[model samples]
Target: MRLADLTTIGVGGEPELIVDAYTREQLVSALNDAWDGDWFVLGGGSNLLASDEPFAGTVIRILTSGFARIDGAPEGFQRVSIEAGQNWDEFVAWTVAQGLQGVEAMSGIPGTAGAAPIQNVGAYGQEIVQTLVSVDLIDEGSSEIVTVPASELGLGPRTSELKRHYGEEPARVAVIAGITLDLRVVGTDPAPVADERIRAALSLASDDAVTLAQIRERVLAIRASKGMVLDPTDADTRSAGSFFNNPIIAEADARLLPESCPRWPVEEVAETVQVFDLATWDGQVPRVEAPASRVKVSAAWLIENSGLPKGFSLPGSRAALSTKHTLAITNRGGASSDEIAELARYVRMRVSGEYGITLNPEPVFVGVEL
Candidate 1:
């Protein structure tokens, strides 16, 4: 089947073998059967940018769906387990309807629940790491399923150990069968917004209180305005969510950027200090302190400053930047995979030449190079 019809970006060639697994057992069998050959799992197909060249391997699509409230949650939280194939936004909607408070700010993200932890999926300031308790996983060659804790996944800003970047291999090769999340049990009650960005976007005061449904409504609306929420009618949402991630750079490098560029400090561990008794100490020198902490700079700001603006496109090319958001490179009707790649390359080159920083593509590339 053509991956173009399957993916959100609507760009890709065909796969040699397509395996649709509708149950956990079938998924396991498919994975085991393809273990010795070239294979990859497909969930919602939202975070991929496949090539026009055909995929020379088996593609396993997970279609299983289900979720249930499990026992044994902390005092004010409730634990729920979700299948890997469940739609992400639908799950978020369910959470809001039930008045859960953790994932409300991440309402309109695409893809499935299983893919969340792979990239530490997040929006505004709400990340899966905040509430993810555990996941049922199986390694590449293992026949048994294991429940892995969230802490071991190496979750970080827009990345996790399992995520395969543009030209890098993941630290682990495994499939998540399901995930468990611990969400606050605040049914129909108002909760204070903890994320500064969400508060600013919603125009809520620091002391203001809002319901879970309210938060989800506002987040979805905001995403729609930026062409982030999926809609067949909106060509701006035709591409993979974000073309590039916000770059995290060293403090010195961040300082070299223009003052108007937006940047945020990344939390860093404080340097360890060693103390000795002055009276009984030997003549040993103390260790020097660590360098300044890193900061994350906005990629959209860099792109616009580098001579690329919203709706910009190369002459005679169908691929263009989204008119609503500069971070997205949209497929205008019949754009080819090569056209998308060309636009992405041009953007990267311009941004690098202007800011001396390389912008990395966020989507997983299959049989495609930047």
Candidate 2:
């Protein structure tokens, strides 16, 4: 089967064989076998780019799905467990319908729940790390199933231990089977919005009261306006949502950009791991301070200011920047995989030449090079 038929962008060649795992047992068995040879897991196909040539590895598509809810937890938080194959937006909608508040700001994200922690997916200042409890997975190294907590995933901006960045190995290897989340209950009552980013995204005034459902609706609307929500008829939506990640750089480098450019402070978190002998060692704790110096710059702002505008296209190619957002590269019907790569490289080159910064692609590349 051709990956084009399964992917959202609809541009790719055939795979040697495509197998779908509909149950946890089948998924686990497939994962165990995949470790013996070349293989990769496929989720919602929303954030992937395959080559025009036949894939030379095993492609396992995870289709297992189940949702379990446990109420009346500590401080009245709702605990829910869901399988990897469940659609993320559908799960978000379910939370809104149930009057849960934590995930309401991330309403229109594509892909599956299992892929969320891999990228630490977030929007409007809300990320999966905020509520993710754990993920059940089969480790590739030992071929054993294990439940990994959120703290061990190394969750960061669009990255985790399971994520494969360009020209770098992933910190960990495993197939996520299911995920658990914790959300607070508000009983369908309107309350003051807590996050500033959400308020700005929705253009709501401070002190404005809204419900969880309202937040979901407004977030979906914002995504739709940016051509982020999937739609068959909208060519702008025929692409991996964001092609490049917002670059996190040193605080000094961030100041070099134009004052008008959008920038956010990314604090450098220092986690100390110390081992001490509790039985004999004297109880004297030493504290040292380290400087926090990091900032995340907006890739879209850099792209536009670097001479590539929204809707810009390469010569004689069907690949172009989305008319609604500069961060996305869309397949304008019948585009070749090579054409897409050419456009991506051009964007990276221009941005680097103009700002002395390198932009990294966010999608997973299979049988393709850029």
Candidate 3:
């Protein structure tokens, strides 16, 4: 089957072989069998841009699904283990229906649950890192499955230790088999939303009463309005959720942008000191200082201000910016991979020339470059 047939963007060439793994054992066996060869693990196929040229490797499509309540949940929380291949939206729906609170704001995101931690998936102020407890996976060159805590994953903004960035290898090479989350059982209770971003989007005051169900409903509505939620009838949804990450640069660089540009300060995390062996300490006291804070500027703002408005496209190309969101570069039906790449490159150049800040893509590139 063509990669396009499986992906949300609908524009990838066929791989030499496609293997679907519907269970954990099948997934592990497939990985072991393809360990010495070129292979790519495909989850929901939502965040990818594969080349039109045929892939000369195996594509392992993860189809496993299931989740169950497990022991070891913290006070007032429940621990749930989900298979890597479970549909993320379906899981979110289940959580909301059960009155879980942590993931209510991330309701309409596409892709599988397994891919969530890889990019530290966040939306409407909720991130996977907030609830993720641990993951089960097989490390590279190892045949046995092992559990690793969330701390070891180096989860960050749209990045993780297992994520392979453009032209660089991941710090760790492993395939996730399942994940565990600790979620609060708030069940259908109306509570004040703590996330300012969510409140702003929903137009709710700080003290406004809202239920988890309400939040999910609003979040889904917002995403669908922006063509983020996948629907075959909506051509605008035929693209990776977001083409570029919101650029996080040094505070000084952010100051150079137009005053109207939206930006937020990245929180500074305090460094954890593991040990302080006084016996080996030097006589002199060491000086302590904090680094400068970073700022995250809006990519959509940059694109629109750089003379590329919503629905912009090349003269004769089928690829165009989503009419509903500037951040998405959509496939306007039958667009080639090159067309998508071309539009992305042009968007990057325009934004760079206008703001002197380079925009980085968020999707995994397979034989496709910008």
Whole-model lDDT per candidate = 0.91, 0.88, 0.91
TM-score of each: 0.96, 0.93, 0.94
Q: How would you encode candidate 3's per-residue C-alpha lDDT over 6-106 as one tens digit per residue?
A: 88888999899899999888888888888888889999999999998889898999999999989999888999999999999999999988887788888
How many collisions between residues are there in candidate 2? 0
Q: Give me the overall lDDT of model 2.
A: 0.88
Can you write out model 1's per-residue Cα lDDT over 126-236, one digit (the tens) per residue?
889999999899899987889999999999998888889878999999999999999988898886787798898788999899998998888889999999999999999
- Write model 2 residue lDDT over 1-370, tens digit each, in one string: 7888888877788877677999888888787777777788888999998898988778999998778796635687889998999999999888888888788888888899999999999999799999998999788855566889899999988899999997777998788999999988876778888789888878888899998888888888889999999999999999988999999998889989999989888675677767889997699877756565799999999999999999999889999999999999999999888998999999999999999999999999887777
Instruction: Show where candidate 2 strays beyond 4 Å.
Output: 141-143, 268-292
Against the correct fold, how does model 3 do in TM-score? 0.94
Q: Evaluate residue 252 in candidate 1 and report its C-alpha lDDT on the 0 to 100 scale.
A: 89
Model 1 ranges with Cα > 4 A deviation: 269-271, 277-279, 282-287
Which of the two candidates, 2 or 3, achieves a greater lDDT against the reference? 3
Q: Considering only N, C-alpha and C atoms within 3 Å, which residue pairs clash in candidate 1? A: none
